[model samples]
Target chain A: MEEIKDTFLHPVVPLDFQNNYRVGAYLQRYLDGFKEKKILGAKCSQCGRVVVPPRKYCGACNLVMEEFTELPQEGTLENFTVGHVNLEKGQWKRADAPYVIGMVRLDGAANAMLARLNVSPADARAGMKVKAVWKDQVEGEHADLDCFEPA
Target chain B: MRNVGIIGIGYTPVFVSKRKDVSIVEMISEAVDAGLKNTGLAPEDIDAYVFGNMATFEGVNMPHLWATEHMHARGKPIMRFATGGTIGMAAFHGAYYHVASGMADIAMAVTYEKHSEGDAQVGLMGIITPELMAMLSAGIDVTGQSGMGAIGGGSAGGISFQASSYLHRSGAGIEHIDAIAAMERRNAAKNPYAHLKDPEATAEKIAQTPMVSWPIRFGHICPTTDGATVCILASEEKAAKIADKVAWVLGVANCASDATTANLIDSQITDPAEQLPAIMASKKACERAGIEDPKKEIDYVEIYNGFAHQTLMYLEKVGMCEVGEAHKLLEAGELEMNGRCPVNASGGVVSTNSIGTSALNRVTECALQIMGQAGEHQVEKEVHKAMAHGWGGLMQYCTITILGDKPKKL
Candidate 1:
């Protein structure tokens, strides 16, 4: 048997890939609605299913969602998790404090959206009613619709 | 479709966290060489090759091109596949098609992953990076509460939600997850090629590990392993001529649902715990294999359980047991190596996970059991029929392969 020696080599390969993505018409409308404090969802004509942060196609029905509907701010917390650590570039770092990441099912929306829950980890539970929070200043951005809190 | 059987299987010398002794191609060659030696076949005996790996994890693109000489794929038909964690089984399915379609009499599926070469988290984050960047460009503070909370916790964070949902719906607790982790770890101790071997593992010991997220502990997660696995498939005629023991591929099926189950850019339209694709694929595979009741007909199962809970979760989803009954079976000791329906006797992906080889290893493990080749980890029951499952691709894709002791009768 040939003895093998361990060798290590670290090479610096600096490569940055920049990509440009179009927000598309569906998401653009959803974002634009944020400025007015309205939660927009697209309704699939075939299935009548409404999805938040609307997209063009409803995969189950295979139909284009052309109709836009305003979703109610209050909904049920479908599911949640309390994160004790943050993953930065795939590395784990203990968070300063525990926080709640909840999946909120907005009223009239068939799908559940991922959002930060304002409630403490101890107080968070699935199926609890919650409402959306908005930033002080209106902006047509993802940040405009702030975290959700127990209603 | 013609009958195809797994004639031989080969694994790298070891599956560990690091393989500093060998380069990526060199590591891959070890498995290829082992496969050739196992079947007493030379390089020229392989008619085609199907290679798979998560290139992002290794920072290598089109690795098959570089591994051509090592894999004996030079001047041979070679196809590449990458479907997240299921790449291994996907490549195996590709090789099966090669032989089943009569294009090649002998085909080899080669899958490997060297996680030490690149960042696993970074590779996983790459799936949703474009979406995050899109939001960041639109003035969304991705580092803030809204962005980080939704998409920041890496794979573990996202999976925690699924775990919690599974617990809630299945009436199982975190203790069941602990139990499954301990069970698989103990199973790994019997497998020479497995990475995380804990002969004295117990549910209480696993429960002591710190929680990464609610319902998910450090002990429940799979380690990033460096290893390669190669499986050779041949037509029935060729298999009879070359190998005395062959694991016949009775049925193979895969299904993909919408990618929204991962809750990446948008919200989740489907419940992550409600793995419809697994149900569909398993049903289709079992039906094609002429299996009426998997619980009674199937003798063994190899589930691609990256998380311990998945072993139980997929059992229900694949119709091995009633929904929410897996944990109950666990309590009855029915899922153990000596139990009625032994699952993951080779420790499963939860014990040894090299993402690219994880799924393929499931098939190979089942084949080994079917052929009565799994020495130390072989289940007590005689395995006449076995099922192998692979899950990946943003939680939407599922591949199922059913292997039998004898080839299906025409």
Candidate 2:
């Protein structure tokens, strides 16, 4: 058979994929509370696992979490990676070539947070401490806090 | 173990990077032809088909539709398999079982990815629960995701943190990762089919390359690729007739995690959890084929090392190491093509990363070594036994296969 095109033609159709992410109405109520400086978490009925960024169910116990309460906005950093690169078009593009990406442990909860911190690549080591920044309640949305940086 | 030999194998010239030269259909055709020619057989001779495609790579609602028509065995049974990076091998696992279970006399497995055509990032965008995204910021990007892991993993004054404890606990160092890149670079140089197989590959170059993730430099992580790979399976009875030498499929397995990226840490204490499926299918195959000592019995490997560090991880997860020693073995040069048990003599995915078809390519490479058809990349000593592995879906899904010379009488 005749060969049509070589394998080195297109590496990737480069594009920027970004969008405004949304949250549930019930969850928005917690975000509204966070704007008022209240940390909200979900309490599991079947298992005693408390969930921050409050969820509706306890993943481990396979039970619903209806009891919602304010929680401590504090948690430790878990396993993380400093990404010096950008995740776009399925390829890594270096911004400054080194940045921190990690999972934050929200206080009084089993599951940790997944996000990037505003710390320099050199200072974003694991087990470091971080605090949540909240947006003003009436004029804010969930992202009003931006992202957690070195606190 | 009942001997399960590869009767056919095929693949497109390794596409170096994303290319628009061929559509997914044409890519599959090239691979299917290579497979048919290698077996000295025709596509019509196959009885069934299995295909693997990571839809993320193609941006297609359903990828692998190309296989429905392009990869022969028309109208016969066909199964499509997927698991992020390991999709290719997952399909191979299905094909192996089709023949092993007596479902078909001869079976074919095909896999490919048109990296040039899709938006992998868009697919990854779905990682956070839709609810979580609404709760987070508007400008949040993928980099932010890894940053979250770091923040949760530990603390530092400024350095981007890694899974500090787990990484340190693994006893693996930068040298091990560097060595892996260097080896693949050298290996890719030997492979004309590889994308970045520049002749002057070196450890320094890989280390000096831009860092994508801390310790994960450009060379250390595989490039997104477009290409295709295929394998043909047959009863030992049919294979012996044409394959002057055969690479038997000893066993195959695939396992998946919940539909969330939440398992990236805590649950991944062992990660690659490749052993769960590998051990299950291996035991079943060994029981049917009667394999006693896999390490002592198997001779080589063509593991799917999409990221160079994974090579060490799999050797250990496959039950070949005591936890962290795979890195030691890796640093000691024990996993090289000339080492005690050569892995990925063809330089593997590290040298040439083929998105969808990498696993099948791994299986085919093993088959080639057994048949002594592997060219400059061939192993030094005769290889009677080999193993192949693959993973994807952000390292959540896994697939593994064992290849041997003959079906052991159970």
Candidate 3:
């Protein structure tokens, strides 16, 4: 066997890809409500449950959720986490500051929505009252519903 | 449907972080050769092939198309599945269905993962990429306050919430999590194929590890391993003719729930710790298998526990024990290799996680125990029946398979 050198001959190939995803009719309408500073939930006629970030189907009832309803701004924090690190793509790095992320059950909606909380990590508790804060300048996109703050 | 049995199982020579000497196809061929060697069967005997792996983990798409010759699957009907960590079991069940449905006399389920070849985290994030893109299009930065932007908590962060909830509801402490991790690591030490072996692992040692999240330590996580696992399934007649000892498949079932809580992004009104899908899938499988009481019938178990806490959590969810009783069982030494009901005698996914093989390993491990061919790691008890579990697909999907020493009574 011969000793092989020039191990540096390994080549680097960078593959870049961009894709366009259809927001679909359900989410498209939900985002449209953001323009009017309103949050929407789809109601399932069979189960009578309201799902936020509106979708076309209710998994529990297996019914078409075509009935759109407006949800209240206030909610109860169902669950949360205090992140000490940040996950980027596939790498983990220490965060400059720990932040609180909460799962909130908005009023009048049967399902919960996830959003960052504007509170200290120590103060973040499950079942705490919170209200949504918007970006002021609505762009008809997801960011329009900014982080939730303690109510 | 016809009766199906596992006739043979094969694993790579080693489960490690890397296989630098061989290419992806070359590494998988090792297991194929081992399977053929074990059952004295040839490539021609296998009528079909069912392959699975976490796609994009190795930077390759539809790898079976490129490695047909290496897998000895040339001119054979091939099917593939990709269900996150449960792909292995999913593919195994695919082969089981093929043989059970009388489509083929014999079929092979091959599953593997070479995490060393690509970035695992990136591959994991790919599951929520579309969600991330939607978040990005909304002008929300990818690494903003919601962690990895919207729905970027990754596996560990979300699992922490699960672990915390389990601790709260079960009245188990973080110490129990440490104990479970330590126990599985110690179990891994006895298995040759396991990747992370720690015979002397203790709760104190596990607790010493850095805390990644509340109630979860670094030691509680599964390692990314490079390895392959293959199992050969056959019809009852074929199994009896080809192999002397067979692990009969009494039942097989899989169920999936909402991917919200599993993704750690926007959780619906569901609780991650509830794990309703696991309860439903296991119950449905037990019913199909005619098991009147799983707690009394199952002699051994192999749970797809990527994290140590899941071993305890799933044990209860699968009806192996009453709710909030798995930890108590653990503290009583009932989950050890020589316990009343031994669990993860082959360590578990917590010990050797080749993401694709993790789920399938549970079934194969249980089969080995039922066949009495597990060698040193075999449970001391006379194993009559065992249950193998696989949990994946954003943690909402579950696959349950029941294996028994005797064939199912038709």
TM-score of each: 0.71, 0.64, 0.71
CA RMSD, predictions in order: 24.5, 23.1, 24.0
Kindly list the per-residue Cα lDDT of model 2 for residues B1-410, writing each as its tens digit: 24567877777876756544455665677787788877777656788888888665555544455345456544667778766667777788788778878888788888887766655455443323431232233233423444344322111100122222225658777767777778777777776567667557667777787765565566666666777888888888887787777777766666655322232333332432333444454455444435576567667777777667767766665655557877777767777777776777777787776667887788888878777778888878788877777755543456667677766554
Model 3 per-residue lDDT tens digits across residues B119-165: 67667766754434443444555555553422333577657867888
Error of 2 at A39 (Å): 68
Model 1 steric clash pairs:
none
Task: Give the DockQ-based CAPRI class for model 3.
Answer: incorrect
Residue pairs that clash (backbone atoms under 3 angstroms), model 3:
none
Off by over 4 Å in 2: A1-151, B1-3, B62-67, B126-166, B257-293
Off by over 4 Å in 3: A1-151, B130-143, B149-153, B262-268
lDDT of 2 by residue, A38-113 (tens): 7677887777777676754354553446788777766677878866668799987778657677898887777887
**Tens-digit lDDT track of model 1 for B140-207:** 56666655554555567667767888998999999999999999999999999999999999999999
In order, the interface RMSDs are 18.9, 17.6, 18.4
